[model samples]
Target: MSSTQHTDTLKNVRTISTLLYWVCAIAIIFQILVVPLVWYAPGWVEASTSQMTVSLADLHALSGWQKYVTMAVMMIPSLVLAYGLYRLRKMFGAFAHNAIFQPEPIRHLKAFGIALLAQTLIKPLTGAATSVLATFHRPAGERVLSIGLSNAEASTLFLGGLIIVIAWVLGEAARIDDENRSFV
Candidate 1:
């Protein structure tokens, strides 16, 4: 690419990185307020007709700290997702600063990939656990143990693999660049 195109691409990356950084920051901050928000805003938190099989009212059925545990079970993956987005923001920032061949961006990519993989694996387990917890206060007939591998999870797993492969390819390229420098 020409200098102008590269500079424009860097500008675009920097803008996207900034947007993602703010989004991640806000998501992480919002996670801290979930319990209170659920307490005060039941209608907003609980959507009975939504695609979500279990509503906040279902989670509200849990007694004492068990409710918090259920919330944590749900929120933890979101935090992981936020952290992954933050890592991607950092990686994009590195690209914006012309640090493509450096270790830091590669490390960020690897971390983000691992985070995505972890989320993909944990989501089904957490969903089942959350369903069981939500049923804790429900009648026997209403209780359920559910698990499934959705398309979203599959796509995320694929994206995680793609990111890891990209990171490995970049690492190899960096090593080759170093070797070439040595030959000069």
Candidate 2:
């Protein structure tokens, strides 16, 4: 192939690379801003005669701006992810109807892997954050966000690393396949 062809292919790959980074970054940022609020917001539980138990549902019943704001934040992760995935899939180059990658309907499958981490962390973060705010003045026992992250949060790093490795393998396979085709 001519130098121009090689340059064009490299340019296409570069665009895909930029897309991968942007999608993942947006997912992480959106999760960061939203999940903590949901996890930490107040809830309701029955109280004993001697002691009191706050119902977690009490937070759900909150009215006016509090309810609306919390709901909006909670939905941010899903909305941002859907939009980013749409863009990333477009950039990744879709599989044809009969392509080996099947489901020409999908894109950014690997990049959306970040959403899995978001699922595991956001709940706990929101719960801890809500508790901290509600009891801001109290003794602050066992601050979930402060003392240490949950086991799930810690595992997410490993999952993200694994996703990266899988992406590398896919890239290497594509490169090898391209090189072999050139000789044919």
Candidate 3:
């Protein structure tokens, strides 16, 4: 492409990246704050948790304290997700400043990938913990300690690995470019 066209494309990338950065920021906030609030509502909780593989019977069995503890436990995955979003935001911020091949953006991408991989593990654990907590008050035989993995988790694992590989490739390319420039 011509120099002017390349410059224009980079400028467009910067604008889009800036917009994505803000969107990620908003998503982080929503994940941290709004999601937990939604859990407090019975209808919302039932609607959301109904899709879970592990049966969560008698969610009402949880006392206020138990519910709070469960909510906190559930926040573990949300916090992980927030961390991933933060890394993504940082990556986008770097891109917005036209730092496409810089180490900072690549680092952020790798971090985000790690966070995604963590979510695959942490999410199932948290779900099990939440289930146990929710059913703790139940009779001994009825108590739940269920652990399950869904397609979503598998997809996350795959996507995370892919992103890490992409980041590695980008890092290598940057290194080669830098070396080539030094030899010129």
Candidate 4:
């Protein structure tokens, strides 16, 4: 590529990276703050839980402190996802500064990958916990403890593994580039 073309491409990358960084930041904020508040709205709760295939009857039965606790339990995966987004924001920030192949970006990429895997693993447990919390008000035989794994979780696991491998490759490339620079 011509020097001008390369420079323009990097400029475009920087602009996109900056946009992604802000998007990640906003997403994290929304997950952490706005989501729990929105959960209190019955319509929103019903819509979201129904989409997840969770029993609306169990959810509707929750009240008072049970609702708060159930909401907290359901937020676990989102919190983990927010942490991953934070790492992604850091990586994008480095890219925005033209530090794409640096250790900082690689580190953030690896951390983000780990966070994704962690969230995948945590999701099922949290789902079960949330179900139990939602139905805990019921009598002993009626309380629910449900565990589920879906294609989405499998896809997340695969994506997380791919990202970790990519981060490893980038780290090796950065190391080689540093070694080559040392000879100059």
Best by lDDT: 4
Local distance difference test values of all predictions, in order: 0.75, 0.48, 0.84, 0.85
Cα lDDT for residue 141, candidate 4: 98
- Cα-based TM-score, every candidate: 0.80, 0.45, 0.90, 0.89
The C-alpha stretches of model 1 lying farther than 4 A from their native spots are 1-12, 15-19, 27-40, 45-53
lDDT of 3 by residue, 1-184 (tens): 9999999999999999999999999999988984456555545556666545344445545668897898788788789989999999999999999899999999999999999999788888887887788888878898878777778789999999999999999999999999999999
Which stretches of candidate 3 lie above 4 Å from their native place? 45-47, 51-57
lDDT of 1 by residue, 126-184 (tens): 87887777787777788877675678789999999999899899888999999999999
What is the TM-score (0 to 1) of candidate 4?
A: 0.89
- Please say which candidate is ahead in lDDT: 1 or 3: 3
lDDT of 2: 0.48
Q: Candidate 4 at residue 124, lDDT?
A: 91
Off by over 4 Å in 2: 1-55, 78-96, 101-107, 118-149
Candidate 1 overall Cα lDDT vs. reference? Answer: 0.75
Count of clashes in candidate 2: 14
Question: What lDDT is reached at residue 148 by model 1?
Answer: 57
Say which prediction, candidate 2 or candidate 4, comes out ahead on TM-score. 4
Which lDDT tens digits does candidate 4 get at residues 1-184? 9999999999999999999999999999986874465455546555455324257556666789988787787788889889999999999999999998899999999999999999999989888888788778888898777888888889999999999999999999999999999999
The lowest-lDDT stretch of 10 consecutive residues in candidate 4 is 45-54
State the lDDT at 36 in candidate 1.
Answer: 58
